[model samples]
Target: MEREHFSRQFDAELNDIREKLLEMGGKVELMIANALLALVERNTELAVQTIAFDHEINRLEMEIDEKCLEVLARRQPAARDLRFITLALKIVTDLERIGDQCANIAKRVKELNLEPALKPYIDLPRMAQAASTMVKEALDAFVRGDENLAIKVCQDDQVVDDLNEQIQRELLTFMMSDPSAITRAMRINYISKCLERIADHATNVAEMVIFMVKGKDIRHTIA
Candidate 1:
């Protein structure tokens, strides 16, 4: 009976951790969407909204960290549970960083209003959406303990990287063609950099999922 009680408590704690992770992921997704909308629509209001979300993301991250520490001290989980908690800690860091990047992009969007948009914002938003989807699906895979889905998320990161590079080249061409576009083009360049960072965060989440499943680090290891 005592063993069963401890088991139940451990499961409950893990469920709580997953819930917080999902909350963080959802907020990151909103940040990305709002930031992109701010860019495409030139809406300062939406940009401000994305900036606000960064605070909430940071708060949730702290709450999750506290809960993880409590579980570690009280439950003393081992093996798979230990791995899950460790990975959750790392995942939250990546999620929080992604939120900051979204805010940075939104800030850039707000400033771009003074100058006409260099282009219709074709590739950047698409790449942000794809990165957001990868994050959502990767977290879903973690929730379900579905290693196959996690693998899919890892594969999707390559697509995001390709899109990011495409955006860079296209923006460079614009700056080269029109000397007047240099300033706005540089702003767009930073936005693309933020998107690339988001893709990197998504890849970090994928790496955590792999560690959770296979009990391997595999972080710097090339697949």
Candidate 2:
């Protein structure tokens, strides 16, 4: 009876970790969306709000890390359970870093807001959307234990990479042609790089999900 009770309690603890992780993931996704929207609309207020929310993400990372540690100490989980706990730790770090990238983009949005419009902003929003979706799908893959969904996330990362490259090339042309546009173009380039980094972090999470579910480490290998 005691062992059974302990088993249920341990399961509940694991569930708690998962719940917290999902919460953090959701916040990071919103931060990315809000930051990009602020950039497109030149809404400095929304950018400020998004930057402020990153503090919450940082707090959640610490909270989840502590919870994982407690579970490790008390439950002494092994095998799949062990993998889940460790991956939870890893995922939160990735999520937190994603939040940091969002904050960086938000800061760039503020700077760009001061300058005149730079082009039509045609490809930047699309790239941000793709990156945001990758983040959402990666978290979904984690919760569903869907290896295929995780693999798809990995595959989709290249789309974002390509968009980023395209944006950089266009911005380079602007800088090459109009010397005065250098300031605004460079800021836009930084924002594009931030969005690209966010996608990279999402890919990291997806790779970790593959490890958690299949016990296979596919980090350095092509997915």
Candidate 3:
């Protein structure tokens, strides 16, 4: 029954990690949504609050990491269990970075609020929605052990990238057409960069899901 006892403990640890990941995912989603809302609504107060929540995301990341390490040390899980722990570690890192990106967007929103509106709220919010959707899909893929869903997330990254590029080009045109628009355009540029980073983090989550499922590192492959 020794093996059975170890299996039970291992499963408990894994379940705990999964729950924490879900919690982290929920918080990050809220942060992203709030950050975007802060910009759209020009609410500096909400932006600041979103920035503050980032610290909690960092703390959750560390806690999840510590638990994963504890499981590794105590159980020495092999095969799929090992993959689960490894993928969890990678995923937490990506999620934490996504949190930072959300904070960065909030910071940009604060800066942008000091100036008059550059243009109508259009592409940036659309890009944010797509990025947030990708993050949620990637997390759902992990939860359901669905490689197809993970691959879907990976495929969606290109749309975010395209949106980023479009935002960049449009901002460039704004700056070029009206020299006075440079300052506001620069803030939009930074916001697009933040969205781009979020998409990258989503891609990282997809890669981890693939690794967890296939036990092969496809991180280097361009798709």
Rank all candidate structures by their lDDT, best first, as comma-separated numbers. 2, 3, 1
Local distance difference test, each candidate: 0.87, 0.93, 0.91
Instruction: Write the residue-wise lDDT of candidate 2 on 39-110 in tens digits.
Output: 989999999999999999999999999999999998999999999899889899999999999999999999
What digit string (tens of lDDT, one per residue) describes model 1 on residues 1-223?
9999988978998999999999899989988999999889999998988898799999998999999999999988899989889888888888899999999998888889878767797788788888889989878977777778877888888888899788879888998999999889889989888888887787778877877888877777845
Error of 3 at 213 (Å): 0.8
Candidate 2 pairs with clashing backbones: none
In model 2, the runs with Cα more than 4 Å from the true position are none
Q: Local error of candidate 3 at 69, Å?
A: 0.7
* TM-score list, all predictions: 0.96, 0.98, 0.96
In order of listing, the candidates' clash counts read 0, 0, 0
Model 3 agreement with the true structure over 85-202: per-residue lDDT tens digits: 8888989999999999999999999999999998888988999999999999899889778899999999999999999999999989999999999988998899899988998899
Instruction: Estimate candidate 3's alpha-carbon lDDT, on a 0 to 1 scale.
Output: 0.91
